[model samples]
Target: MNKAEIIVALDVPNAEAMEAKLQEMPDFIEWYKVGLEIFCAEGPAVLEPLKRRNKKIFLDLKLHDIPRTVGNAVKTAAAHGVNLMTVHAIGGRAMLEEAAKAAAKCENPPKLVAVTTLTSLSQEDFVDLGISRTVSEQAVELGRLCMASGIDGMVTSAHEAKALREAFPDALLVVPGIRMPEGDVGDQKRVASPSFAVEQGATHLVIGRPILQAEDPSAAATAMLNDMNK
Candidate 1:
């Protein structure tokens, strides 16, 4: 078994809603992704509850900015004691390098991963933005840049996980937009099942709707874990 971890995304509107969702989840779920909605609503204080639970936090801010600003944000996240965090790979080499250096200075640095392309985007969307490369190409190209710039890993679709793993065998490949075979795709355009993501070499699987919105969130999470660990 690959032992790929399941990271439940807390996609709720506020800290209260997020706490309710966490209460619904099983204790076996060791990781949680604290994204923009809840983080922005509650600020750094939003992480306190999860810290009390001793759960690992994946802060999915997808930070994008100039070198100095992003570096400062990285330092702040490190201070918050996140286990993992994301920056936009499109932010380019200088920003990525600065983010890496900031992490290196932390006593307990969070593993910094770069976002290659969002799972909600289609290839046509890239074309609309005047980019000629396919989603996979762009992901791999950015993955290379991330490694060269000292980023620890990347957030990519499972569609590109295999290529990324092959190119950078040691890089942490975090795959989001995970949906069960029978589950609704919702807003994500490039989605995969838990088993598919694990088999493709994803180190962490980020699932939101399927598990969080299920009638029995704990059972749903256990089932997804079974699928990934199979």
Candidate 2:
């Protein structure tokens, strides 16, 4: 069986803490996720060091905007040479297609992924947004939009992974709402263990907290990868 690819989320606020956390990461960690927090705070310059080490970057800015505008933003991000980037499927097919087209122009385009539904939300949260479908239903709809847009992959919670994998068996299914057994889940409402996600056909696992907050970040990451490869 193919072990799920492991990518740690660099959710820290600034470059200093990011470097510290990275130092604690095991050498086996070749893929890293740079989310909005650090990207907004430090800009693309923050990614230079990781690129120097040849680490694959998942620039999770979750771009959601008008089609032309999001396409421009995606072009800029692609210029940064990131390995993966996210655009929200909620932005609609026009926006997603624009982003994909922009990436295709790059000599080394980042894999354009669609952000389906955020894992932090619950069913009650969807009602607040006037969304009639359940989170799973919404994810399925957005995932199909991603497929129609010619996007390369998707970002969804593991709870919805099986459904997505069934729909797009060849697409990169990256799940982020992961909490190891007995770990604090914090704001994420739809979460699962790394093993369950992998078993459900998640291609990559974007894990944070449990690994980054541990006293031994490298060891924590190794353990998680161990679980992924088991």
| Lowest summed lDDT window (length 10), candidate 1 | 1-10
TM-score of 1: 0.98
Give the Cα lDDT of each candidate.
0.94, 0.89
The TM-score of candidate 2 is 0.97
RMSD of 1: 1.0
lDDT score at residue 94, model 2, on the 0-100 scale = 86
What's the lDDT for candidate 1?
0.94
Give the least accurate 10-residue stretch of model 2, judged by summed lDDT. 1-10
> Each model's RMSD to truth, in Å?
1.0, 1.1
Candidate 1 regions off by >4 Å? none
The CA lDDT at 217 in model 2 is 85
Task: Give the clashing residue pairs of candidate 2, or none.
Answer: none
Error of 1 at 112 (Å): 0.6
The deviation in Å at residue 104 for candidate 2 is 0.5
Model 1 residue pairs with clashes: none
lDDT tens digits by residue: candidate 1, 1-230:
24789999999999989989999999899999999998999999999999999999999999999999999999999999998999999999999999999999998988999999999899999989899999999999999999999999999999999999999999999999898898899989999999999889899999998998999999999999889877
